[model samples]
Target: MSLCATVPDWQSPDLEVFSFFLKFCWILRMPMPTLQTGLPPGPKGSLIGGNLAQVGARRVDFFLEVARTYGPIASFRIGRWRLFLVSDPELIQQVLVTDARSYIKHFGARTFKPVLGNGLVTSEGDFWLAQRRLLQPAFLKAKVVSYAPIMAELTEAMLAKWPEGQSVDVAFEFSALTSAIALKTLFGLDDHGDRVQIDQSLRLTFELLTRRLDALFQLPLWLPTPANIRLNRAIANVNAVIDSFIAQKKAEPPGNDLLSTMIAAQHEDGGRMSARQLRDEAMTLYLAGHETTALTLTWSWYLLSQNPDAEAKLCEEWKRVLGGRAARAEDLGSLPYTSAVINEAMRLYPPVYVIGREAAADLELGGYRVKKGYTVLMSQWVNHRDPKYFPEPERFLPERWLGGLAGRLPKFAYYPFGGGQRLCIGVHFALMEAAIVLATVGQKFRFTVDPGAIIDIMPQITLPPKYGMPTTLMRR
Candidate 1:
């Protein structure tokens, strides 16, 4: 059986623990010696596979273990691939900002290119820079805030359907709301006719892509395999849905929506994006735009459900600030506690929890030599829980963020949206959307998470609730 199949699923830890222990036994045979290699400390792995097997299906936990056991700068191997986990804030700054030009996204990110194409997330070099410049104007604070009415309108629509005193999957609920918002904001579509097909196809494609990334040896896409066949079909379905939207958008006069902005955006030389470029950027925006905010709201509600005091405080703030009206863009500044709750929740369950880059040239990080091709991983999962910066790191204390803690924290210390030249372009839009959605929903209703629901982390490309957050809708 495959090592992946050995672990029943994320829900059951017994087999996963046993599987990890079995692989971990290989490390016991090796000794920890510096050997003048100048490499940082990490767990030894089997001679053939390195730490790959040991990291099976528990990468988030494994990364936490590596950081804790090996210190700020840690090294390990997976097959011939070398990876470094940088936990120190200063070193993280150097990698992400100061010397960012010396690196590109890591191999794992490239694995999604088949689906994501040469979009901003996967693109590199001059082309990526040009595209970023074009998209920057649309996501600026002024432009993002203009969409607040649409966000509030859609959120209220969702709240209307949320049955009070009924059990619902909060994950699915937030996902649907964010999907509607993304559809309206991205493509100027309110019908959401293609959403089900698009969501199903994207989910399948992501699952298969993850499996391919985790496999010891990646098979070529051309070669026919059951997984590959399904992946191809899923990709085809997603592209079909996207193409239909692009077609629809092209048929209409330009609007203020993101797709229209991309279509109409011109370069200094009077050049607009090509059809392929538009599709790629649209695909990137369509996926990246909504998933993070949805997860943010999903995890926020989950955290609030667990911490009633925080939830109560949030409700109190909304009551006082908005006077029972839905949140508007102008209300953002007045809603500091609302922002803190969202910030704190993101700090704990960051949507894009881990990010990595590959060294394009040999360089020094934290006084250690990093060879070209070495992948450097920065995980919000590990860093956010660091005891030094966030005292009582495990606690859900929104109050911690109340007193200018964000201003006081290190630049990289609380980076849920990431850092540096490649910081998420949707930062302003996402923050505004989450704040609007949170305030709009909190005043009228609260959630009590199902007592028996098994909550865990999926830890795929994004950090999602493993089994879905089932909760009872409590009308306030």
Candidate 2:
């Protein structure tokens, strides 16, 4: 038993949290490394480190285009903010894996900023390490298995509701489906008022975070513009809901859900999370747990819909193995084809397509001179499509993953979950959930994209379908 044990199961009273936060405020720290100057060749920027030009619409995509022109190692500036774009796999491996402690996360991850409030996703110092260690036990293999029944239940429920022979947007469905699964698995709640409020707040706050990429850190958050207003409202709603949930949880007996585990977590140092830390961690789980998996599933459905042959192969596998019964998470190991299919889909349309890192200190990389104060980016969208690794990269070929192709690909060449010490903490959990959900949904219905449906890439925080992936679901 630790501080987490002594703290109330639900929200801590306001004053306790307020007092801790007030004492903690005004303490700023940046554990930055020194920059090695005269780095790689890249585009030039105006005063303020190219800040003016970089703060426009299409920020992520536009930066990707620059990576294309400037080659593997490119540097640019946005109002004195040195942005480094690296495409070479070796250099990326070095930055993320070989010398991991040298770099920190890039300047983007702000959506989690307000909600998670320096939880695992944002913490960089000892706090992050400590929290990560305490939380690791809950996501282990055995613990992940506990989540499967919830995954199966939710997927089947949605499947039951899907009207056959009518086209529905798979992307929208995934958004809802994954969010539902996240809520159920993490908080042990189904569709309820409090649960719905939490989900609604997440969408409102994070949706704004993705759309308002151009206005980060520039203006006050309380501004009345559509983006600011919606964002603030969403944050308030989310914070309030979390606060109440914490209070309620504290007054009750403990359970086995993620929220409970976090509440019960304690450190060897005899420290425990404050109520605010709990809220932020919960928010982090909510945000990171759902979005990317939804995008990957949507694209997988879209791709299979386009390739009838692939769909037929998948059907053949399902018919043979499932024999008209629903598949379970444990069945994933037996469903080799499904995993291959997912791998191929991720290659073509990776979730969180690009990774961003900041230069702690300037150092030479990939034969290019670099400077400090630069943002370094590695694009999964680029490397996954590279001809050297994936021949005919545009083609949707699941066989490649089944054969020796995946094994032959360079270590860093296929990093959908990112790499280094900052690799996604939920990688194993996400993989299992996605596989189970895919098998269940794919085996039950034959879905295809609605003809003439626009497939614009809304490359927001995640590369999702802009127009939404419309598909007709038919019973097998």
Candidate 3:
């Protein structure tokens, strides 16, 4: 089937009628139509660019405001595209699970294709399914648990350098630690391979991606604008790093690391991913696997710093279970409070705050008729803070999760890792890593964020501290 065939034909006479209707409304200053017209109520955006300028830099806050001011299903526009933000849990379920195949990754997600390529995060249809199948084994609970020792080892290595009284930027420290762990566990690189280069390139690339997402107009990447040239160079640097990892892995015998697993994995028909396929999947996993977990840990530390009672409770749990030893897979089950702390951190500051999908065909959603090519956005930042499901939603209450609360809540209400088949593949890996690192570090060191640190969210692809989390290291 042709891609163009699936897109709505705006050239049809219906657009002329819509234009006439808008002119009529402008002349009389009448209110826009509502659900009776098959469109949900939304904020009134500017005529030329719709809500593009209103969204501006604080998009996460804007999404929350929109969901709160309007109902669960609200309509808005960004340039020529019609967008809907779905905040209702049941409605979210319908889009992500019941009718999953009717939607594809939206333009916001597609912005990373220059770096992520057609890996699971950006790919669609049968190819994404096949790639997911081949990669599933590497992230299963059994396989993921086996990587705990490596996580603990890398974390301990990082902690070794942190003297008790020294100050550290917790964000940068966690990012470097996780990047090293990712290089080892994902690509079979025993050392930090291209860590500095990879970090610089990723920063530049993601900065451009965020800019492109907010821009009312954008040039194709093929054009040689200054931003495009920088983006290309940044991408080339990352590709070089991935290529080097692949070359190094090829020379050595296969190991238990994920890249090796992907290399050896075969489909039911004995098909395998080509070198390019491997690069795409590796890039996706490398970015997805590390940064989100890093933010999880970084934010966990920041939250624990502010709430001493929660920090003390977490530390006490670690003291009881770990007893001055490094955390292992066996120790995780006994550390319920540790898990709670991580969960609460993600609730307040979800790394991947929003999930978006564009309708691949006309469909009914939340009692409204959504046309093909319309975009639907569901934000964890909004749903996780619903007062009905979570009383005092803004408070950092790890105890809220202590007594089967997770099981009691609506499925989509607290999905920091998202929901349904498209849920992050690294859910288990990320949870386990955050728990182990939190336990191992909390047992030895605690961070005290400055009282006036100017900590705020950057609202990039992942929610990171705007000023970076600077804290004094206090030994336990």
TM-score for all predictions?
A: 0.91, 0.85, 0.91
Model 3 sits at a Cα RMSD from the real structure of 7.5
RMSD of each: 10.4, 15.2, 7.5
Comparing candidate 1 with candidate 2, which one achieves the higher TM-score? Answer: 1
**208-267: candidate 2 lDDT, tens digit per residue:** 776555443455676787767878888899888777766666666887788888888876
Model 2 vs. true fold: TM: 0.85
| lDDT, candidate 1, 145-224, per-residue tens | 88899999999999999899999988988888888888887679784768878977887788889888878899999888
Q: Give the whole-model CA lDDT for all candidates, comma-separated.
A: 0.89, 0.76, 0.89
Q: Which stretches of candidate 1 lie over 4 Å from their true place?
A: 1-35, 268-271
Q: lDDT tens string, model 3, 155-250? A: 999899997887788898888988888888778796664887898799888988888878888899999999999999999999999988888898
